[model samples]
Target: MGADNQFPVIQYVNEAGSLKQDEVKLHKEQLYQFYFMMVRARMMDKKCLNLQRQGRIGTYVQYEGQEAAQVGSALAVEDGDWMFPTYRDHAATMSFGHSLRNLFLYWKGRLEGSIPPEGRNIFPPAVPIASQLLHAAGAAWAEKKKNSDRVSIVYFGDGATSEGDFHEGLNFASVFHAPVVFFNQNNGYAISVPMEKQMKSKTIAQKGLAYDIPSLRIDGNDILAVYHETVKAVARARSGGGPTLIEAVTWRYGAHTTADDPSKYRDQQESEIRRKTTDPLLRVERLLKNQGWWKEEEKERMEAEITKEINQALKEAEKFKPADIDELFDHVFAEPVWPIEEQRKQHKRLSREGIQ
Candidate 1:
């Protein structure tokens, strides 16, 4: 594709796997790392789906096709940076040093999943749409006040753009010149609601213009493009250039979540067709092939490594103690309210009577 003519669709590699070297500079190591992370994300997604089916996890949101968008932007941030992710963005969190066990524990409904590893600034996945945007802006603004160099990156869905928090966050960030990257994955739907029905704007990136923020829309499935663009955004923030909004034009090949049926709201056949041209991993594989880095042995080795890593994490997660019901009330407040105390007592009484 003629990328220059397509102002917002910056792509370094074509769907056929052909690379446009003039479009973006990349090293073999970076490409390989992208491939590794994408595969790992896919594996984790598949495993999570199976776990849900087996009743090992609660409802889950799958991000199989958007691996490139998640992993690329995730890898672009510094260790000190903050990450605000939605329920579908565990891949991004895991890519940024989050423990795989903790992620799985999250799906199992454990509070431990919310805790970030030491020195890692990762937040629990947000289920309330677009709420994280405000958190990201607030944290980044705080960082600026402390005269720290840390930036914050927030991820949201195309559907989230419609929320009031989205606009409020953008406005706050722009007014404060906060260091936040509003990474939007325009995956075409909010549940069954199509993008056209969701908004009238020509593009999500265009919405940033109203806030006087720098914005760009890119081929989110193109890992190179995502990495390069996010790196620039982060750099700009670090240098006090303020916030940016990046709309990653991507897709989710699976159902909105394991709980819903895609056929009920979307054309499943059309999704199958998207696998041909817009599948993130296939494009990266094509890139690898063109670079002469595609090897059967390497592929097998990577799969084995991923399998081992996931299995180990799964074991650890399973070995964890069952979550306490009281934990639900504990974290919400420093001191329990009367209603909460009464409920806790009721539960305790029920437990003693073996009726809980």
Candidate 2:
């Protein structure tokens, strides 16, 4: 199916900045905040890619074109809410108050990087794909049981929806009325497998219908739409309306990760085209201009400040010594089982032999 036949793209502002002009109760300050977050995210993504190239950080996942979807939904959550992110959703984690230094450390292969600051419930990125959905559903169910209004939001890619755990999670959440939002970023492809090859369903949002959950397909590039719709979904979840599934239709301008090349599977020209029209930052800039709140000077200043901040975070992350090889084996259990101890000793012997 072509992009147009997917669904009526949910949007509040056009690229030209002429708002639908209804009483949506949007404020200029809110729009500016969204714009700043998107810009910061884009800057961080670019920095990480460069750091990877410099051999400073490990392999990186760049979320260049998915800023609005991440920032918009992340900003909708309150401080007490829990966030479950995949390796590609760092923008959401950052917007939800995850430390930039820790994020950099995470890419640097430090386990400590996964630890959230005091009272923050951000989980480490789940690289095993949709496995985090079960955890999110369980956490939200426990919160519901405790009568707390806190909601849990889980981020996954379109490819993740095909995992058995995804269906299981939505089923469990629907049955238990768990306060969780399953944020599926339909970025056209899962690694190299396009959505059509990954699933038979025409639309990801429609997947939630099996479980009787409320779901919507939104134009993920539209920051305003992403934010408002997420705010409503989260509000509904908090008000005992159970889980909501949001399929944010967006694209990734870069390869799935630094380790892959897009030219191998798809056309790079499409990404270049996306840069012109569907770029998330451009849409926000368009909105700002429509409202006469955008300034070129302000954009340049913001970019400069963000670059400095990213550099400072990188410095902090690099200051820490590389993770101890043994530390990886020590954390799994209170008392290392005999099998683990044997493996650890074997690992040490191999290291002494200069095997790696």
TM-score of every candidate: 0.96, 0.96
Q: lDDT (CA) for every model shown?
A: 0.91, 0.90
Report the lDDT tens digits of candidate 2 across residue range 49-159. Answer: 998999988899999999999999999999999999999998999899999999999999998789888888998899997999999999999999999999999999999
The true-versus-predicted C-alpha distance at residue 284 of model 2, in Å, is 1.2
- What's model 1's lDDT at 39? 93
lDDT comparing candidate 1 with the true structure = 0.91
Which lDDT value does model 1 have at 8? 59
Worst 10 residues of 2 by lDDT: 1-10
Residue-level lDDT of model 1, residues 247-330, one tens digit each, is: 999989999998799898898888788899879889988888887878878878999999999999999999988888878778
Any idea what lDDT model 2 has?
A: 0.90
